[model samples]
Target: MSNHEDDVVSALKRGADGYLLKDMEPEDLLKALHQAAAGQMVLSETLTPILAASLRENRPSADRDIQQLTPRERDILKLIAQGLPNKLIARRLTITESTVKVHVKHLLKKMKLKSRVEAAVWVLQGKNG
Candidate 1:
């Protein structure tokens, strides 16, 4: 029965993995619980559109912004999006760890992102356009 968007968002931020309405069917609740237990985020159907709209509204201009990245920067970003640490990324790319850090710093600055997690989420969300 909860309809407050802020409440739902707050619960999610506090590590609530699933957000189902009280009125959902028993079978649906069971299904959601199973999904959540499997490490999936389960939002009630009614909340999906709201979340989609929020994502769209907050999404950056990734097409143009991504174009600003150098080829090497883009490679590093793709690896970062894969959840690789700087050291692993450096080893994979055959670059020094310090060089990887420099590239990450410059790319984050150019993309107006503050952290590797944000970069990973941005790319995983297909915000690269």
Candidate 2:
């Protein structure tokens, strides 16, 4: 039940581990809670970019306008670059096979890539282009 962006930003900046609307499904909320308790921060996916943008605002050069990627997406891209299949990437990332497909879709869109091979090439090119 927190919508004040500044307050939300502050909590995140202070390293609060979990942020979710009260209306989230019980299963999803529990998952986030577990992740937080494990000392890993769990942010609402919608809030991720806000956090990224705020950090970028504070450190412009270091941020460099790079496409903000979820940790999963980054991991998938690395494996894709390494020529792994979706099933294998799923196993490595510890996510369901279907979730891996979703990550692949988002990665392709975010990276402006058309296929896994294109993504692999982009990574191989050191993400310069």
Candidate 3:
């Protein structure tokens, strides 16, 4: 799997043979997919921190102002980290575009981020922190 987002991870856990990110250059993504189809583990440097950070403590920080998101929201957060468009997230989540917007708004508020890019960065950083 090669995507740097949760949807890809979910897909992988659900049995995807390959998972290239939308951000990857077409040539590289094609190469990675080819490698995956060849039975090789195709990965990228962007994935290193995520793999490393999956080991974080699970306890919630009561002192923080960040809202505790629902499991569904967390899933959305993962998609955001992948830099997916709201329409794409809606398609993946099987929700309406308006609903995805609401989730994005909620995520921005909960994470105290001013932009989706910031939230994406935070999600990546949180994984490795």
Candidate 4:
């Protein structure tokens, strides 16, 4: 629904609590709804294999994505995880703030994340290798 490359991927990015197909079994749909209402992340059982295959074929895993970062980008990512602003990161890295901004943009794109917070959280969650 939001601006995204794909609907399923977009939904996941937007923090959808659950993903269910229209053709789901009535009982399973109800159960998924209940689980989501209880603050659980739910995915349709049938969708698991298909989603996994699609992700494996289409998108890099988090570690793979992190491995794709340039050294400068990785440094910036660590700075971001430390909650440093671009100016501070630039000063610490002895790069222009604009250059820091550019690196941030590239890193976000490489990680397929939307914003600095997401990038920070991703790194904090130990995917920043």
Residue 109, candidate 2: Cα error in Å is 0.6
User: Which runs of model 4 end up more than 4 angstroms from their true locations?
Assistant: 1-64
Using Cα atoms with residue i matched to residue i, what is each candidate's TM-score against the true structure? 0.56, 0.47, 0.48, 0.52
What is the Cα-based TM-score of model 4?
Answer: 0.52
Model 3, 1-129: lDDT tens per residue?
A: 345456544554454433456688889988877765644445555764553343233223232233477667788888877756677788899999899889878866775555554455456666313
Candidate 4: residue pairs that collide: none
Worst 10 residues of 4 by lDDT: 1-10
Global lDDT of model 2: 0.63
True lDDT of residue 94, candidate 4: 98
Count of clashes, each model = 0, 0, 0, 0
Residue 66, candidate 2: alpha-carbon lDDT: 29
| Comparing 2 and 4 on lDDT, the stronger one | 4
TM-score of 3: 0.48
After TM-score superposition, the amount by which residue 88's alpha carbon in candidate 1 deviates from its true location, in angstroms, is 0.3
Per-residue lDDT over 65-129 for candidate 4, one digit per residue giving the tens place of the 0 to 100 score: 67788999999988877667677888899999999989988988878865564565556555555
The runs of at least 3 residues in candidate 3 whose Cα sits more than 4 Å from the true structure, single-residue gaps closed, are: 1-67, 127-129
Per-candidate local distance difference test: 0.72, 0.63, 0.60, 0.68
RMSD in Å for all candidates: 7.2, 11.6, 11.2, 10.3
* Candidate 2 residue pairs in backbone clash: none
Model 2 scores worst on lDDT over the 10 consecutive residues at 57-66
Using TM-score, give the best candidate's number: 1
In angstroms, the error of model 1 at 27 is 26
